[model samples]
Target: MSSHQSPFTHPNDSSYGSLQTPDDSEQAVVSEEDQEPGPENADTDSTFGGSLLGCDTDTLASYITDYKYENGRQYHSYRDGEYWGPNDEHANELQDLAHHMYLMTLEGRLHHAPIVNPHNILDVGTGTGIWAIEMADAYPSAYVVGTDLSPTQPLFVPPNCAFEIEDCNMEWTYPKNHFDLIHIRELFGCVVDWDDFFQQAFTHTKPGGYVEILEHAVTPVSDDDTVDANHFFTKWGETVIGLGEKFGKSFTIWEESKARMEQAGFVDVVEKRYKWPMNGWPSPQHRTHGDDGGKSWKRLRELGVWNQLRLYDGVEGFMIRLLTTVGGWSYEAAQLFLAEMRINLKDFNTHAYLGVTVVYGRKPGLSRTASTETSSTETGSTKTDSSGFTVHPMPKSNFPGSYRGMT
Candidate 1:
């Protein structure tokens, strides 16, 4: 099929359209002339003003008295899936590539089955319901639940797996004493109050429960080789962080989350990290390109190009203001920038520390607690075998990716 052909029409993905939420769910109208003062906009009810996150006016008004979405380049609305989910416009090959990379470098952590079977499990911020669904399939005896703010989950679910649409920001309302394993992955924008959220998770969990959080460690990289500070992609990380803060979320949530879990009195905390390529090329020479890595790059292009337009249309004000008031950049100019984003998504040369980290804390068992009745450490606790996969500790150097050959 031609690249332009609609993949939605394909027999396997006929429900893609129905599954995706339409942009029509809510639309923002930005007018420079009628702009309200920031203090007034934020001081009182902000029903008239708009939020960058997808919550409607009533929802925003109920929480923040007055909040504007502007943080960095992108504004509030851009975070919504409709605004940024343009990944479909790119070649489907990239989509497959991303999934493949996920299966590879990303999926290894999931391969290690728990030495002990968990009766109840929670997959926090589960995307596409893939991991949760698979886990359900693996431990059919376990009750698996996946939760997200957006109601984008498929209607169908395995008998053991259930998906719920609820904000992780709100305090967890599960029974006071429940849940054996709580697993969260790639919840970059989904978790706002990591401290409060995890505290609640700890409380509801059974003694001997397990909590796993997987996240990406994002810090800027610098090399003797001068790269453009203004390189849009390089600074794009801030956009990801900015949008998250607007929604009361944390992109780099590991440190505080650990302290919170420990404060909740959980024992046996362990953190493991891994690095993966963002693009197909491993080095300047491309000497060792994993077949799957090549495919992952194609998916990178598609996922990226769609994100550009989303930032423009999704943001609450920044994009609208730049185009309307400044007149410095035209719509055509914006499209060109987006085109550049697509091109750079596959660029791999300078090393980037695109590493994945998993932090786990185990809920202590009642019998074990009684047996110890003293120290809080798990030194005497039974240690399970590491998830039968290649594991690496945190990178000593900042640039962990192998893209840079000279290094």
Candidate 2:
């Protein structure tokens, strides 16, 4: 694909701004004031109780193969109501789109752990199992295992890759100190207790193994201040963060995962941050420069288009249940709010972007007795992997995409 083209875009499609610069005369810049009004007085105490199955573990285990249907979406029955997102085909497609977006952001690198010759790899909450399948392909010798609450993964995968219907929130049954790398991505609002979650990762990861987490901030922001606190899109983010808090699972993982990893007895913790523009807003810069300097801008525009498509396609599956169950909004009210949010999201003038943070840390080697010692001595030190590639701290930028920043 060309640097400026998104894989999701068709050759003749102009809706994604494939043929236009950011400042094209045809492009309309809709200011927040000019946009239609959002839903007002949304019922915060609507009588729409959620569709949570209040069954015990034994009862759920009997029908673990079943899925709960609500709001025209399917959710995992194993841990009903624990996750806000759905497990249906639409959700799965969005998951794959997100996987591709992450690849685009990382420049096609599956991971940043610098792992060499991994023997066993574990992908937590693997969703559709695309990453695990790719990893299995990348390392034929390595046994790749993907665990998720839903059995949405494809039946045919690489010989070395396997999918398990499991929930990461519960106690893990995997062997201790086994996996060479434990990879997690985009599990922001799903996790309730991150400390215990990372502790489980630490316990299951082998000595000197690595655990990597990839999460994007839930809120949207703009460097040029085009989007403000009162914007409907901004309110959508604030509402999601608030719902997460009410559900006891904060959407602030991007800001908290690094420290949580260190506390979980992992060493060499590092965080790399990137930007996911909300739309093709950055494409104009590419056309303006028409030089090598425009390459990065072009790539950003492509990524932004992908990001916008994913979010726009995923808004219903993402917020329907949360609005009704956690936020106590009626189903109709939730739909109205989501409709307004979608309209705001389509505004290219907003120039909003979501911040992505990839945090990776290594478990202490078997020779090390205490994690405190490792943290004090080698916390931020740059180290070279066996492949002789130096791992340095990536540059940081002033992008506010986290829940804390929204506040």
Candidate 3:
């Protein structure tokens, strides 16, 4: 790639790189289910036949036609005027960088679900298809399918992995009781109906399967009260929540994901919350011990830098759309307002952080006792038989005082 090449000049894994400014002629095409034919049709004809799906050009266009452009970036117009995020190449690359940064925070793994040997996986809102690709690599036997409104995934992927253009708000096309693991991430502003979505997810999930939701609380919190009532970040969060309410979506849905999953008939629902520092502020609690037995100041600083960078590059795209489309602010006014927000983002002394939550639930099947006993025996428990070697037993399941570890 050239020094001035776009972050998406080539198809690759989710990793960090500087995003180069695109020229006037360069743009990413958004795919909607009901777009009228135009010049993009001709462009699609020449650009999509050799894609990973290996379908004809017209067939590919059929999958990705409805779209609108803003700030020289393409966005999905599927469901006609819904979906708040962009589907452009720059946005895709930024999303991939965020994904990679999140993997670093999670030790390069996807989720905390205790699923084993899952044979069928579904990745909802699979931006860049990086998670699906990594999952396919981790489980070669699993058939991984990533679905999104935009067809922005790479053309080449693992044999077991595939990408589909589908609006999750609409009816799912996959067969019922099919997927062994259903993973959803970072869909705060996209999904309109949580009940309908989870009901469909429950119906599609196989018995004993798991559905995991990973999302970050967009509000930034400060420890020493540096982020006050007048802060732009705080106001930004308030505006997002208010906008979500007006649009019939909830930006704070992750906070109640466990209860929602349980309402959808999932069992053993567990929620884990993690924190990511917005910047390096020398906070001992947020600091990590180095591998060489010293304070990992450099690592912490890098994480802070990446976190701030991801936010700086990301906020404008979504914020502009929100302010203009929903808030009814002019583009110039939105940018003028966001300028202060960007300055606040660069303030390292604030010691701010974002709360990330990972919620996992199992489709109801066996009783908790049976499931625990089966897991305990499979994991080599202390129970033994008369033989010299350690034996496995279906020990009588003992209920615990608290359902902490059992879930």
Query: TM-scores, in order shown?
Result: 0.54, 0.73, 0.73
lDDT tens digits, residue span 1-407, model 2: 00111112121223322221355677678775675643321221122111112123224444665789988889988678888999999999999888877776665668877565678899999999999998888777888988887767777788888877677788887788888899999898888789999999999888989999999888987776777888776887889999999998889998788999999998889888888777887864422222112237667777778888998888999889989999899999999987887787678777787878889999988422222223322235554444444433322222223311111
- lDDT tens string, model 3, 1-407? 00111112222332212233457589655566556677646334535433324334334354355578876657875554577778877788789877865665554456667666578899999989988888887777888888877768887899988877677888887778877889999889888888889999999988888899988877877656777888767887898888888777778976878889999999989887666667665455545323212325554555567778887787787677777888788988988877877888778767676777788899987312223233232235443222333332222112232311111
Cα miss at 264, model 3 (Å)? 1.1
* lDDT (Cα, tens digit) per residue for candidate 1, span 379-398: 33332223332222211112
Q: Lowest lDDT 10-mer window, candidate 2?
A: 1-10
In the predicted model 2, the residue pairs found to clash are none
lDDT of 2: 0.74
lDDT on C-alpha atoms for all candidate structures: 0.48, 0.74, 0.70
Residue 283 local lDDT, model 2: 61
- Candidate No. with top lDDT: 2
Q: Kindly give the stretch of ten consecutive residues in candidate 1 with the minimal lDDT sum.
A: 1-10
The number of clashing residue pairs in each candidate reads 14, 0, 1
lDDT of 2 at 343: 82
Between prediction 1 and prediction 3, the one with superior TM-score is 3
